[model samples]
Target chain A: MGRIYLGVDGGGTGCRAAFWDTEGRRLGTGLAGPANLTTDFDAGIANVRAAIAAAARDAGLSDDDARGAVCHAGLAGVQSPQTAARAAAALPCTRARVDEDRGIVIAGALGPQGDGTVLAIGTGSFAGRRQDGAVRSVGGWGLRLGDCASGAWLGRAALSATLEAADGMRDPSPLTDALLARMGGTPQGLVAFAATAQPADLGALAPEVMRAAADGDATARGIVAEGAAWMERALAALGHAADDPLCLTGGLGPLYRAALDRDGRRFVPPLGTPLDGALILARAYAEG
Target chain B: MGRIYLGVDGGGTGCRAAFWDTEGRRLGTGLAGPANLTTDFDAGIANVRAAIAAAARDAGLSDDDARGAVCHAGLAGVQSPQTAARAAAALPCTRARVDEDRGIVIAGALGPQGDGTVLAIGTGSFAGRRQDGAVRSVGGWGLRLGDCASGAWLGRAALSATLEAADGMRDPSPLTDALLARMGGTPQGLVAFAATAQPADLGALAPEVMRAAADGDATARGIVAEGAAWMERALAALGHAADDPLCLTGGLGPLYRAALDRDGRRFVPPLGTPLDGALILARAYAEG
Candidate 1:
């Protein structure tokens, strides 16, 4: 019997879903608004369902076909039973499973039978490993508490660099000029901009921090260097997991790779999309 | 007429006001609600007024006498013209002055003409210096962006150590027990606590970080050592002012001092209360 499958990577910024077949071929992918339970529990569930529906449409499949599909969601904010319940209530299917985003990211990086480790970075960050086929993870403490070397960290570093420039402690930075332009040329404007700014918004400037460092902004360089140090700290916390085949993902992963001076077996996932991980997860469930 | 003066310290957790005379004799003092500008501007102003009014009443001053008194406030959110104006409008005095809490703190530490430097370390932290009668500052970029080595930083470090302990990346910490007890035994509970927790609240447990260090929690030792380093960094930055007689105040000041390993040239102010600085400023204006 032909079967459909759905995979999702749910994070603070949004819920992303992908549709797949039993052979691990991705048919379609979709993006919806944020699905992190900490911010909006009910809305997060709605977003997951909507993202699945949209991906099915993109795959030219009907709701009935989608309903028959098995689904797996790699989600942030699953640290609690309430979050899991909220997600389970939203996605109706033949079978639905939820795990931490770390699991999905690792599955994508290492594959079903692949024995390795992965660090997922975007709005948040964490390292996951499959050692002797038992999965364990570290880091990814969420934005306010941890998630070091993640996009949020990069964004916060950019803001710190800009503020240092305004405070006259750091020499002028290229990122400062770019940030000021985006913030309308005043420190007060910058403050207002940062009042509602998120990790992704700041992560968007990770490239700018990199560019400024290249152009000799000592402070910007320091910020990125500090960021690199934080990443190292996280990696250190991973212990033996660092020796595993380490894969990097998210907005900051590629940008920070050159800056990371470490002795580890490293590889970049080829697909350039987390949706591929979702599809693989989906296909595995379909095959089972 | 023996003139009365009002002194206010508007901080993150609350606002405090006291009434005193030119002779440095405290007449009365009162405490009120939170006064942080980033979160609660209106409440801050109201709290300041409420504290002052209560102080006046306790000092046995009539409404007319209070209205004629000189008032000086060191406020948390006086950074904005709008907030400063709101504060000035609220004080029931002809000569009402509002300044950054840091400025007032320095003034309080040194007396009005007692020129020097100060490290204010309450819920937040910053270093301020006055040289040749000009004010210069280091750190205190505010809680979210900067204020490294402050109470908030200490608290965040404690939390990080707790998580590291949970993951077994570091040796178990006394801070782990303190934090686990404080956090109600879960990571999710800890996040919820952190959402509303302040720096001083965390700094209160700085001893745990120090104790954990002594007990060989590498993570905790690292936190205290890093705090010392950050303090050194702030001192180095403030070195640009090229002044003498640095003072340290705020909640973490006394706690972090011996760990700092700095010289006696950096004086701890004799006065216990920051209100003395407000009194000093009021007296200076009175003399002028």
Candidate 2:
């Protein structure tokens, strides 16, 4: 019967939910299966509901109380406002808000009221800033158009460079040679793969490029440098100040963090995880 | 009725058929609507049939005679051997061979027995050569993967440069400014366009980029120079010798020819049309 808050963060990997009472003390948490809404809406929504239920059970709240709880969810594949609104309508909680998983990273990494920036670059890329309780973002345009500095973008660039090398436009290198070998030793092989490759499929190659760059492969180094340059440009375009507290997140986040730091970018470590940000949002919304 | 050759050249724009007798005397020629077999297979086939019928009528040959004549078709969108086979099977001709449109460009430009190289950079790109009755090719990978020096590739690179400029990674220039303005004055607008753009849609922008380059726009110049460089590399990769009969063909072909010629490339003019190449192939196949 008392005020309760539910915070849910869902991505391709899995879903996490945190429950807390009105006093801002955590009651319990629950984990669930992968919940990428865009790829599998039914499964994602189901997993989301299941995670909330488990969190409620762990918190000793009745099913009805849990359903009545104020909730906030940050999920992957929430591309449009319609998706967000639909997700909110689908949730069990009576008072619920749904948002792209990215938004929560800002609060999670920079604290609920922090004024700084966050760069989330994995299979996709975007830069965000929360200032004066307002949030603005740039560059979540997906791999086909943009998503510069993202894992998918990096992978695509590497593959492109490999093909260019094969065509003698670029100097062949160890990385290009290795990539060519892996892609069936011909440009056709890469072409066949690219014909049906999704963003994640492309992003799958980012680690290799990064690893090769670390080992001083000229081609890989150039790729990484270009990605790093894009990141810097993104930050600047986001109006990031030299002294702003920057937090990098996502799978390729750490690699870029190092690159940016080495390039004189002074970044601050995240205060918490996205789940924490969700919980913070849940509490803030309920309290308001 | 003794021996007649039918050469069909089918593309996105239109289809042409040339009919010839044993001594290589031209019988007649016919034109029809767009016959790009890949995009509109039924229409393409219908148009091809219609064109051949018209040519037969012009040559004073019966439909049966035309169908029995040895035939060769060079068509756009013949990406695979299977498509070629399928096209060959579907044509009305009794003895027919099907090949990608690019192949015929070599014969058309270099003559039936001419040993030479050809670089065709239109909405898509490919480099090809015919020597000693054998044809070899490279770099027809398409816009998504590797259409080096193609119009689509140029447009994509220009758009990418525009986005990079918007992000502060690349220096903003007149070309980028004009592109941004034309594309709704925002990176998001470009992203929106790219989200659903086909190769042709992207290639549609190539003319503007080329024009800008011709007018001394720095970003446009860089894009064109890059495309020109790819042309050189592709020619070299295809084993083009200093004295090889190089022919530049396609919508963007002349633009690149100018660039390549300025860069010391000596290109030969087409000795015939794709229809001629097809007719030549028909004769070769039937005689043997």
Candidate 3:
């Protein structure tokens, strides 16, 4: 059987799994249903296994070959240490490793040194640092507590700003008109639409905020600037770990790259997807 | 038919209605199911109606007398002006007035002179100032945008502080044990519990945070202090609005009173329940 390594990035939206050789060559890629461990643990693990199996099948590898491979899964909702072990146990692999999904992304971004900062800003915003075989993180306090400068934060801010404009407390901005149109021209409609809204749903409106800013909407611009400011705070919090290369990943990273690239901070893009970081960890354990 | 005025405070937990006479004497009160417009607009309206009908029935007022009297409602999830109008139109009264529940609380606290501030801290937190027939509000941006110092905010902060403690970056506090116990004593259990947890559900732990602070848990104290500081910032944002008596209401108020009062800021308890404010408004309109 051919030797393979598997990596998985389990997020709220979907599960992504990838297979690679020890030499860092990709062999297969797989995608599956949403696998946020917090929401559906068993289902997440199942989707993860199914994704890995599908990837192996796509690579024309037998079950035995896949079984021989080590796997690393980066997952969310593993806030508790006990869940870490359970999450590791849930994956269908002879050898597996698991941690907070952001940690995996940071590992990938920092490579072998793994001693810098990484900001993951998809659904929520979190900055993680790797130091001396230990990791520290900041700012994933969820949607209710913090999540500022996060996608969810940006969207909710945009909506409130729009409402403020509508109420005449502030001047009308293009973002307001656009968001109102999106929410069916009524705050009540917006409230109803938000019943099922997720962090990404709010984050998705980030571009509109950016677009409005580009078009000279002072309020929208200010919101984007505020998001950048928050990212700055997250990175600064990671300063406790060490001062090294800071990597930026996720959908909003590119949007705020220029702002991040300020203050002599080195914001490098990740060398590998989060899943690859998982694979690297698994292979490290297997070889040891 | 005897004239009877009605006031309603419709929120996430349920609707509270109070009926009073033109002489400012409370006649009856009633309660019903959750009526937060953000969650269930129709149900919210229904709950208000149910509470009012019960209050009227208990007051021995005929439908004709109830219809003749003025009604005032303070509601949540009624942000946009158009939505406010729609919500106002839905209530079962001949003359009805509607505003954000927080607004009425502020109005009740400040009255006609309109020089004070009020903090509405429950599942959410917001501050408002009454100034010459105008209201200036700060925060209360919901779980997504702002809501710092609120029950939801405290609970979320408690979790983050707990996680930081668990990770050894911060000191252990009462919140850690309380949160762990709440999460079923296992990490996986915590994640599972939080996966389905509502913001209000997390808010239930806010009182424990207060208790911990009172017991001199540094972490809990720090969290409460932060909430106070946020409230201060919110109050400051009101600028001229904070020139008079500042009122603190909601579940967290009494607990944090000493800490907040230390600023020498004139603090006042809400004049009455929010429904009383509604009733006050109703009586004013009735007399006019």
Q: Can you rank all candidates by TM-score, best first?
A: 1, 2, 3
> What tens digits encode model 1's per-residue C-alpha lDDT throughout B1-288?
478888888887788888887677888888888777667767777888888888887888888888787888888766677777677887888888887677677777766664676777766777777776777776675657777777677778788667766765566656677787778787667677776776666667666666676677766777777876766666666663333676768766766666664444455554556777777767766666
DockQ of each: 0.41, 0.40, 0.22
Number of clashing residue pairs, candidate 1 = 2
Clashing pairs in 2: B109-B270
Segments of candidate 3 deviating more than 4 angstroms: A21-24, A75-104, A112-117, A127-150, A153-195, A207-245, A253-269, B75-117, B131-141, B168-194, B208-243, B254-269
Candidate with better lDDT, 1 vs 2: 2
Q: Whole-model Cα lDDT per candidate?
A: 0.72, 0.83, 0.74
lDDT of 2: 0.83
TM-score of chain A of each: 0.83, 0.90, 0.89
lDDT, candidate 3, at A281: 73
- Predicted candidate 3 versus true structure: per-residue lDDT over B131-153, tens digit per residue: 66667786665664456778877
Candidate 1, B211: how far from true, in Å? 4.5
RMSD of candidates 1 onward, in order: 3.4, 4.2, 4.8
What lDDT score goes with residue B27 in model 2?
95
